[model samples]
Structures are given as structure tokens and as C-alpha cells.
Target: MHLTFTTLAANQTHYFLALCLELEKQGYSTSIISFHEESNKLIADAGIKVFNVFEIYRIEKEKNLNIENEFSALLSKYQIECPNILLSHEKVTFLIKDSIQLKEKFVLYFKALEKFFNELKQTHQNNVVLFQELGGFASIVSSFYVARGMGYDNIYFEPSFFKGRMFFVKNTFESYKVQENFSLPIEPNVLAYLENARANKTIVIPKKDASHYQHPIRKIVNTHNIKRLFQKLFSKYLSNQKEEFNYIGSFVYRHIRMLTNRFLFIKYYQPIPSEKFVYYPFHVPMDVALTVRAPLFVDQYYLIDYISRNIPNGYSLAIKEHPAMIGVVEYKRIKDLLSRNDNIVFLNPDINNHEVMTRMDLLLTVNSKTGAESLMQGRKVICLGDAFYNKSKSVRFVDNIDNLYKHINTALKNNAPNIDDINVFFNSTYSQTHIGELYYCSKENIAQSSLSISQYVKANYGK
Candidate 1:
């Protein structure tokens, strides 16, 4: 059996390597299909076969044939549409004007992956793919399509309900664990962990970038992005030119937008803590939660319009800017876009998340962890996206704009938090989750994570 690691970054390479090495001890041949050159060398150093994209890129160039058509057909066949938000984001300005370059890059990527696929069939036995996240980004999404099309089994490792724990799911957008007779988490330690997290009211920011953005100055100081600084400055002055350095302009706009949001938040978005409100914790625009799972709900402003019109008379719609996007979007711009009649109140992002959840008359989310966390509190949640907790009776699922009003009324009027349901969900999640943290975990935690991976493989694929 070949354990092929298809991880995203060089930072995660060590952790993926740890799993591969542990499995290697059990008669499994190890391989890595990576974009990072350093990761290729590291895997090779560990006596694992390395399949780097540059190697395939080299092969493609030597072919002297433009395989862009073939690559486009493959992407079309897989229905792989690169996220539109990428072209506009300032940090990674790969896609600006002439989306042709973006398409060309992905075409070559898929072509390299085809070469790698051919090699996998000839050199490996019982091959399987491992990914941290699929269907979220461009290159990774391309890899997922290529691998799945070639008839390989994939384990899409997902973050479990518990922080630092993980579980296997078929897809990121539509995964729901079906288990009956729910009880509290079987592990005493796991239960304690949840209790502590709830008591302290810690918000789990999904991406490392988001956690860093909490303290923007420290994030900037630690980051060696001076090159981007100049790029942002020059892109603005060269706006008349075709998208050569538009990322520079976009970058400059992003920081300026952040400052603007801070100013707007103070000036216009002041929400009295004592007033009745319905919470809608905003999400990172780039996340799969919105882009992949809830594409229609991508425009929060539209949903806000619906909520503003339909919410009960006394309850104000309190929306918080997603911490991840605080530095990216202009909050004042969002506020000014709405008419004065839209009974809306914007909450400061810095406020304790649990306080926001607990105080609100109702918590509405488009597939956020806020929904799950709210449910754990026995609080009724109005979920707009397909979420793990949508099945809970306490959660009101809204699928259409026409029905959102009815659903909100139903949830608000009759739904009360069920402590028993919360306990059951919590227990089931812990009992099923493989104990370990995915990133920044201690050595012991890594070992436990590897063991969890091994267990899943043994249970599902082993003879």
C-alpha cells in the first residue's frame, strides 16, 4: 500500500511526514505528491518516493505541445471553477487582469498531475490520497479532481467538533455524521476540554492567518512581506496599465479598508450590550463554508436585508465582521450600503464571542462553527448553510430566500435550547473524533494523530 501525502504547505510537511514514517514501519510504501521543493527533498531523505509538480512541468515542456485544451476539458469535466474571490484578494495577486494566465497556470498544474497519476499507477500499489482540505483553493482543488478521476480512494481529513481533534469525511461541504442515541462525550478529558473552552469563551479561528490578524501589528512585523508593500504602492500608480502589478494596488486598498472599517465601527456600528439582538457571526469570504457550501448566501448583505425586514420588532440584527476579514474589507462601506430603514447593528469583532452568542435573542449563521457552538449551549440556531449540526432539532435550517422568514419565525417563536440534545451531540462528537490536534500540536499529540489515521485506515481499508 502507498500512503501518498498531498498536503498544502511546507509548514505542514513535517506533520504529514510523521504519519508517513509511522505507517512505513507497518510495511507500507510511502510517497508524497507535493508542490514544495523542500518537502520533496525532505520526503526523499526519509526514503520515500517524491512526486514533485516541477518534474512533471519539465516533462510537459519537453513534449512541445500545448495541452491547455486537454487540461481545460479535464477541469470542465470535473466542474472545477476557481474561486472568483481569489482575483480580487490583495495578498495573493496571482489572478488580476487577463484570467488567461490563471487558466494557463491551472492547465499546466493539471497536466503535471496527469503525469504524476501515470507514475502512481505504474510505481505504486493500492494507492490512496490524503488531504487536509480539498475544494477550497485552486491548486489543491485541481489535485483533488485529478486524483478522484483516476480512481483513487481519498480521506478528506476534517476538523472535528472538538478543537485539536479530527475525523474522516467524504467531502467538506456535505458531511454529516449519522449516529443515534446521543450521549455526552465518553472521554472525561474531552468533556473537561469542552467545559473549559465554553467557560473561557474562546473563539476558534479556523486559519492561522486569522489568529495572527487578531494582532495585526505583530502579524505584519513577523511577516517578511515588504515586497508586497512596494507592489501594492506601485499597482495603484500603474492602474491604467494591464494587470501586471494590480496586486500592489489591491494590497494597499486592503490595509486602508481595514483602517476605514475600524473608524466606521466606532462611528456608526455601536450596539448597546443590554439591548435585545439576533447574532449573525460573519464568516471569512474565502472559506468553504460560504463559497462551496453556501454559494447563494455569499452576499451577507442580501441576507441582512431579509433579516432586517423580518426580525421581531424589538430585536436588532447584530452582525460582527469575521475576524479573518477585518483587515480585508471596509466595514463602513457595508454599513453605508444599507438604507437607514434596515434595523441593523454592527458588533465590534473584538468582543468576547461567547458573550455575543449568549446575549443574543437568537443566533443565525451561514454554516459557521457559531451554529454548532450555539447548539452546544442549548441555544436555537438558524443555519443557512448545510452544517453538521443542521440535523439537530434545536437548529432551524433555511434553504431558500422565500422560506428564510418563515424559518426564522419558527426558530425564534418556538425553539428552545435542549440541554439533552446538546449533551448528546457533544458526547457523540468526542466519542467518534480521533484524539489529536492537526497543527501546532505537541509531539505526543502528533503520535496520537498518526495513530488515529492508522486506525481509520485499518478499520476501513485493511484486510
Candidate 2:
């Protein structure tokens, strides 16, 4: 089997590489087709064949004509034959554009891909189209249409989170001992443990994101044609505290039941603590202010300076660039912006957001997933604008520089949130099964096959 992984950026390259090495170890050949130079270098440095799209030679030519001709040439080179498995990385923005325009780009890209595969079928009929974590709404819906139109039978979709019984099964068995009982979901031992934990409030970690809101209801309200009508309806209905609490209360009930009743507990839950930090996660379309549509301009550096200069002398600010934004953001520009502030501390790249937020006293974010996670972790999250979790007392939503400073000061003295409270917030909102179920896959098969890959490679290809 020949496997090829396609990507523009190398954000999830490690995950793809792990999958590829597993395949190669199983006596299969693997290669990477990446558009970025950094991606190619990383794969090649790991002893994998890297097929680069545009390189030094391609860059030598003039801009427009060069990119057009080179892109065509690159496609032609790969157009020879289809591989057994072709996995596409998540769709990334080639350039920033309006959301409406971005949707058009997505449509065109998929349509072009549809045409490519339609042609590829003539030579190599044995091809599978696999997409990694349908990154966004547009991409997911687009892939569904493309896959159906092309009639490519081998289609696989998986969730990107780590939640479910299967999750703890593989993890617990791996930690303790693998057993046949672990394979079954209705494990009496596990249920008893989880029940006990819930009763004692021992397992106070965060719940899934969707549990924080009525996502489907919100989606309908936001996406419907008559926005004004729904806005009025929402305002009227939500205005009543009883109605609103009942609405939110019912949402939490489902997750609380599922978690306490279904999933088993393990003794290995990671601990999180309270500390203070300035978190600037990388989000897209240049100005996150636009995407977030917040009432203020969220200049991360400005926020950092204000915090460092005004937040007294006792608090420490942890600054971290989004893991995915490492190459995208010019760190030099950011460094230059913060050159005057000695109080800013950059976090280690490998630090998990979950762990970091748990220990942090407060999290400062514009509109990032970390903000949502921070809210769920029961940390005092100070949002500068309309983040997903901007509604909580644990969260202080500000609209401008001066207001941000005001709220930051307020948050410092506000009530501390316990982990159980965080759980309640998350449980009362989003649907747990939507994204959580996907993360809880049975990875035992993947792991066993992966381990066998190295042995198989040595047996077939020699040491």
C-alpha cells in the first residue's frame, strides 16, 4: 500500500506522521506531498520522502504567472496515478478574505477536487478519500458533498476530541491491565467508580464544550434568514430568568447523567490549579476582531502591556502564541511590540492549554477555544470581547482597552470558581454527544497495528 498525506501547513503533521509510520511499518510505502517548505523539511528530516509543491526554483520566477504555471505543473506531477489511501489535511486559508468570499473559495476548491478525482478514476479506480477532522462547518459540509458526488466509497470521518468510554477503556487498560471486560461499555466496576466520583464531586474536571450551550438551537437562531425575528424571540424568551435557567438547566442534565452514569472513571485525571496569565491564542483572518465581531479592537500586545503596567507588581502574565500560529505570526513583530514590557513571560510550546488554564488565576483571551476551556476549568476568564464564553461572572467581557483594564482589575478581586462550578457551566450549555463521541474511539486497533509496523518494516525492508 502507498499512503500519501497532503497539507499546506504542518500543524497536525505529527499525527499524520504517526499514522504514516504505522503504515510503513506494516510493509507499506509512505510519502508526503506538502506545499510548505517547513513541512517538507520536517518530513524529509524524519527519513520520509517529501514531495514539495513550490520550492526555491519555483520562487525564482515572477509572481502570478509563476504560481499559476508551477501549481499546474505540480498537480500534473501527482496526476499520474491515485494511491491506495489519500488523506487530505484540514483546509487552510490560502489567503484571507471575507467569510462569504471564503465560502466561494471552499466551493471552488472542492469542485476542482471533484473534477480531479473524476479524472483520476480513469487510470486508478482503487482510491480512498479520507479527510481529517472536517475543520469547520464549510469544510465538513463541502467534503460531504464532494465525497457523495465523486462516489468514492471509502470515506471515513472521526472526531478530534478525547472523550468516551472507549477512550478510558484503552487508556485504563493500558495503564492497569487490558481485559475483555474493558471492551464492553457496560462495565459494572467502571460504573460504580464513576458514580462514586460524581457523588463525592471528586472528578471535577471540565465537561465537553457543546455542553455549555444549546448549539443546534443557537445555530438555527444565528443562521436563519429572519435574524431580527429570532433575535426578538430569543430576547423575549430569555428575558425570563425562570425560562432561561430551565432552558440551560435541562441542557446540563443530559451530560451530568451520561458522565455520571455511563463513562467509567480512572485514577489518572490530571490536576489543574489557579494562577494568572495573559493568553493570546492564534486565530485567523488577520483581525480576530472581525471574526469575533467584538465591539473593540483586540490588540494582544496592547492588552499585554496594559496588564503588565497596571496589574500591580504581584501578578505574572503568561503569554503564549497559538500552537498553530507559530509560523503564521511574525514573532519578531510581536517581540518588537512587547520589547518594553519585562513582565511578559512566554509559555513553553508543549504546555497543554488544559493544564496551563487550570493552574492560572485568570486567562486573558479575545475569542479562542482556550477561553471556552478556561471557563469550563472554573478559572476566572477575562474576555476582551464577545468570546463564546463571555456570559459568565467567572468571565469578564470588556469592549475596549480601558474597559479591559477595568475588568481585569475587577476579575482579580472577583470570586474564585471551583472545578465543580466549571463543570456545571459546560454541562448547562452544549450537547455532549456531538463532538465528544468522536474523540472516544477505540484506539487499541490503531495502536497494535502501529507497533507491528516497525517490526514489519525491519522484516521486509531490512534493518
Candidate 3:
């Protein structure tokens, strides 16, 4: 089988290369569709066929191609039902505010990406598998739709609820839907992990996973960031490097906003109150979990306001910023939410999430892993979006926001998930998940993960 991996960042490129090396050893052919020149060189040095997306777009642009017509043709050829999916990417919306401009850029991206995939399909025609890290970037979203339309079996991988494991699925930003006939014996490690998490009343995040929540100042000052900053500057000004679509936004403005929020918002955060409340964990801004999976809940401030106004009287709506979004989120928006609603209270982001969940009357979320964690704790939860665990009898999924009050009350009245049911749900999850970490590039991890991934592919898709 031919595996084509799509990578945007340097770290992802390195990780994919390592996986490619391991997969190649198992007699599987691997290639990469790289967004940047540096990654193209690295993959080429590894003696792998590397398709440079930027270079392809540069070549295509020199011909002065009509993007509107090309985009329309591609859409018709693909029989794309929801063309709006292309515009739903967070980066696309974040970078291009003007509606017309966003559509035009997205069309240009579609034209470029369509050409890239066509070139790929020519070289590797049969038994081709596409792999991408689940993200809310325009390229990732576009490629996913384009691949599906072209009859390629595309797989997306993301960090699973269990640390050191990853969930692979065909659906965008959703859990693997296990086939009806599929079943695997529940592993003891799965039970042990859940037991430990419950016993300690804490979730043990892998160091690699926790690294995303590093302080913004520290991240900015890091040697790697400094080097990357210089490289990007050089590429933009001195080098003949084509401007990548992902880098169209101003990082300096983002950094300034993040830093400003970090310093100014401490005063707004209040202690977790003793009063009865419903907890709403803030999602990281621009996260695919929200941008793609829970698009309606993208405006969290609006959701918070709606929930605060609609929930049963006397119960305050408690909220805490996601640690990964500490300074990244807009503090002014959060401040405005607090000012507008008397019952909406802002909690310190540092407080133990499980601790807060334990005290809450009910947890409210939009496809957060915390919803799953709460279910593990047998706590009441009201999910407003497409969470993997929404199928669990424990969760109250709000299908219509108009009936938010009814859902909230219904969840409040419902019993916590039975331990047996929770076990059953996890057993099924364990059966579908592979033992590996996403974006964890340690040698030991890569070797073990590659073995697991390769074995899975062989068992499921090998001819």
C-alpha cells in the first residue's frame, strides 16, 4: 500500500518522516505532501517522493489560472455537496476577515491542492492511503474533502482520551465508528488507566501533550521559536520562497494580543465559588474541536451568556479558560461576558479541572475531552456538540439550542453514568484505539507507534 502523508509544520514533517522510515522497513511505500520548502528538502533527503505544495501553487499561479472557474470545475468533478466546508476552517476565517476575500483565497487553495492531489494520483494510482494530523487549517480540510471525492481512503489521527494513545478515524474530528462486527477483548491497561485517573482524581497528561500549554512568553523566547522567527523573516524578505497561505496572518499582532491579555486578565479571574454552579470549560481558540467539530459553539462568550440566562435560577454559570489558551484567547470578550451576566463567574484557570467538575451540579461542554473525563468520574454532563462520548447514556446532548433549558434540566435530573456502562464504553473505545501518542516524536514512541499503526493497516486494509 502507498501511504501519502500531509504535513504543514516542521515538527509534523519530522514525525511523519520517522513513521515513513518505520513503515518503509515493513515494505510499505511512503511519500509526503509538504507545505514548506524545508520539509520538502528533509523528505527528499530521506529518499522519499516529496510534493511541495508551495512550489505547486507558485507554478500554477505563474500561468495566471482563473481560480474561480478552476474551483467550480473541481467542485463539480468532486461532486462536493457542502462547498461551505472549505470556508469553515479556523485559519481561513481568522486570517481573512472579508467574506469575498476569504472565498477567493479558499478557491485559490482548492485549485492548488486539487493540482497537487492530481499529480499524486498519477504516480500512485492504486491502494493509496492519505494520512493527516486532524487540524482546522484550510489545507487539511480541503485535502480531506478532495481525497474523499477522489476515492482515496483518508485517515486522520488525533490524541485519544487515554494518554499515550491515539484515535484514528476516517471522519473529520470524530471518534472512530467501530464496525458492527468488530470486537476486541478489553485490555487490562485500559481499565488500569481509568482506575488510576479516578483514584487520584486527576488526569495525567503526557509531557508532550502538556507542552502545548507552556507559557506564551517562554514559548516566544525559546531558541526554536527564535530560529523559526528568523527563518520566516528571511523567507518573507530575502529568500525567493513563495508565501505560504497559513502564514498570511500577523504573528506580531497575535503575540502582542496574547501578552497583553496575559498581563491584564489576572484581575478578572475569580476563585471557584462555594455556591452551586454549572461548569463550562473554555475551549482553546481556533482549535478544530470547536472550529470544525462544534462550529455553532465557536462564539463561546455567546454560549456562556445563553447558558447563564437559560439555566435554572440560583445556579451560577462557572467558566474557566482552557490552560492551552491562557493568553491566546481574547480577554476582552471574556470580560464583556462577565460584565453582562451577574451569574456568570470566571474561575482561575489553574484550578484542578476534575476538582471543579466534582463540585459542579452539571458540566457543560462543546465536545471537550473533559466531557469524557466527567463521564469517567460518573458526573452529570450536558454536551452541546459532537463529542465522541455523546452516545454514552450518561450524556445529555443538546440537539437544539432553543431547548437549552430543557436539556440542562433533563441532565440535572438524570443519574450519573453507571460504572458498568462507563467500563463498557471504554472497552469499545480501547478496541478501536491504537496504543500511541500523536505528535510525540521520541524514538521509542515512534518505533512502537509505527508498529501499532502498521499492524492496524495490515489487519484492516492490507490486500
Candidate 4:
């Protein structure tokens, strides 16, 4: 068997390489595909073939080749009907913006990615397995699309209901489909993992730095952010390239938002009302669960407005800001939301999420990780968007905005915690996924957890 690992960033560095090392020990040939040269060096030292995506793209583009023609050919290779997955990109609509020039520019970039995928496919044609962690980026999503379109067995880790646990699926669609019939008792491993999270206060702690979700620190240390700052500065001032791929704009925007917060002195975050209220935890605008699975509710402000206006008369609606989205969402937008909505109150992002969920009357979200966590905590959840747990037939899911009232009523009426479904879901999930920490959490799990790659590949792919 051949295992190809693709990833980006330092956070993904150790976890992915750990997986590769485990796979190698299992008698499978392995290769590493990464943007980070640092990670590539480590993998190369391990005697695995390492492909740096950026360098490969640069080298491949020098050849006498028409990218558009190659891109079209690549698309033709995938016969299955593809949905408009491009719309899932975070800033795609804004980038194109009906501008012919921008559209042309994006296509130029897209063609290059398609060519890279082509090169990648040709190199690994004999491979029976492909492991990827690139669905987060728009450009890299193309590679996953191509890989899946070619019908290679796919697997990726998604945030599970628990803090440390991650949900793995062979195919995206398969995760959403509930089993017809099964008899699997709740696993002890699942219980142990949750207890460890409780002991560590994992769910209770508000994740200050997105980069170090698992790493706990005594004081707020932002070495990761500082490193990113230096990288952006170098890309902007020292590089001096004509290409618009410079990171200055993003860094500048971030700095501006930080400055804006200091000067504004406008506090919108309110106490989680010690009264009856339903909570709607805001999701990061760029989350795949929001953009890909729940496009209708991507415009969170609008969704908040709809909820504020239409929430049942008896209860107040509480909204909490997502920690990572503090600067990304404009201060004025948040201010205007609190100012306009009489029944709506904003909860502080720093508040312990576990406590908030425990106290809240009901939880509502468009497929957020927090919402899933609420389900595990035995809170009544009303998911307005598509979720893997939507198949559980235990939680309330609203298909349309108009049905919010109905769903809310249903969820509130069936307010008792459905521990049975929670156990069943975890057991069903454990059967499909192996216990391993990737990207975040205990490094011990990565080293000790059994590799599920070969088993998944064999079950999903050919002999």
C-alpha cells in the first residue's frame, strides 16, 4: 500500500508526520506533500519522498504548457456530477465580484492548481491510498475534489462533539448516513476520552489562540502570532514581488482591527442573562461546516437578525461571539446587532462555553462544533443546517428558516437529555473511526493510537 500525506502549516507538521511514521511501520510506502520546507526536511530524513507544493508549482509552470487546456482535461477525467463546490470558498465571491479581470486572474491560479494535481496524480498513479488535510484552503480543495472525482478512497478528520476526539469518515457523504441496524455498546475508550477532557477543563476553557487549541499555557503567550507577523512582514517588504500573493494586506487588516478595538471602547458583550434564553453560538465565517454544508446561513448577521425577530415570545435569544472571529467581524456590525435587537443579548466570548451550554435553556446553531458539544453535554439542540449528527434522528434539525419556530418548539418540548442517542452516536462513530489525535490535543494519542489508514483503505478500496 502507498500512503500520500498532504498538509499545510506547523500545527499540522508533527501530527501528520507522526501518522506517516506509523504507516511506514505498518509496511506501507509513504510520501509527504507539504508547503512547509521545514516539515519536508523532517519527512525526507525519515526516508520518505517529500514534495513541496509551492516549489513544484513554480518549477512546473516554467515548462511550455497551456494551463487552461490541462485544467479542462483534468475536469473531463472526473465523470461524476459535481456540485458548485467553488461557492464554498471564504472570499471567492468577493474576489471575483463580477469583474472580468479578477475572474481571469482566479482562473489563471486555478489552472496552475489543476496542473499541480495532474502532476501529483501521475506520480502517485499506482498508489492505492491518498491521505489529505487540505480541504480548508480554496486552492487545495481542488486537489481533494480531483482525488475524489478520480474515485480514490478518501478520509479526513473533522471536529467531533468532544474537545479531544475527532470524527473520521471514509467519504463525506458516508458520515452523514446513519446505519440501518447495529448493535454496538458504548466503548470505554470514548468515556475515558471525555473524562480526560473534563479533568483538563477542555470544554470549559475559551480557546484564546486558534493555533494552540490543545496546548495549555499559564499566561497568554502569542509566539505563534508573532511568528506569523514576521512571515507577513518578510513577504511584504523583503520579497518585493509583483505578484499579489503578498501577505501584507492580511496582516495590515489584522493590525487595523486590533487598533479599532482599542479606540472604539464599545463593549457589546453582555452577561449571559441569568434568565430563560436560547443561545446561538456564532461560527467563524470561513468554517467549512458553514460555507460548504450550510451556505444559506453563511451571512451570520442576517441569520442573527432573523432569529432575534422571530424567536418565540416567551424566551430571550442570546448570541455569543466566536473567539477566532473577534477581529475578523467588524466592531460596528456587532455593535449594530446589539443596538437594534431588543430581545437579543451578546455573551462574552471569554466565558466558559461548557458553563454557558449547561445554563442555557436551549442551543441553536448552523452546524457548529459547539452545537455538537452541546449534544454531548445532553443539551437540547436545534441545528438549522446540515450536520453529521442530523442523521441521529434524536436531535431537532430545521431544514428551512420558516421552520425555526416549529423546530424550536419541538426541541424545547423534548427538552430531556437524550443520553441514549448520544451513546449510540459515539459507539457508531467509534466503530468507523480510530482513536487518534491529529492537528491538536494530546501528542500521546498520536504516538500510541493504532493506525486506521490501512484498514480504511482495504475496506473502501480494492485488493
Per-residue CA lDDT of model 4 for 108-175, tens digit only, reads 44455455446656876746456664254544455465557655555666545544445555545323
True-structure RMSD, every candidate: 5.1, 21.2, 2.6, 4.6
As a whole number from 0 to 100, the lDDT of residue 352 in candidate 2 is 63
Q: Estimate candidate 2's alpha-carbon lDDT, on a 0 to 1 scale.
A: 0.43
What TM-score fits each model?
0.84, 0.39, 0.92, 0.80
Which segments of model 2 are wrong by more than 4 Å?
1-92, 95-310, 324-328, 351-355, 385-387, 399-402, 418-420, 429-463
Query: What do the candidate models score in CA lDDT, each in turn?
Result: 0.65, 0.43, 0.76, 0.61
In angstroms, the error of model 2 at 183 is 33
List where candidate 1 sits over 4 angstroms from the true fold: 58-68, 76-98, 171-173, 178-180, 183-187, 205-210, 223-260, 338-342
Indicate the worst ten consecutive residues by lDDT in candidate 1: 86-95
* Tens digit per residue, CA lDDT, model 2, 14-103: 545655666766655665544335455578888876644333223332232333444344335434122111111111122223343333
Evaluated at residue 235, the lDDT of candidate 1 is: 39
**What is the C-alpha local distance difference test score of candidate 4?**
0.61
Please identify model 4 stretches exceeding 4 Å from their true place.
37-46, 59-126, 171-182, 189-221, 235-248, 255-259, 262-266, 440-444
Our tally of clashes for model 1 stands at: 5
Model 1 lDDT on a 0 to 1 scale:
0.65
Q: Model 4: clashing residue pairs?
A: none
Ten residues in a row with the worst lDDT in model 4? Answer: 212-221
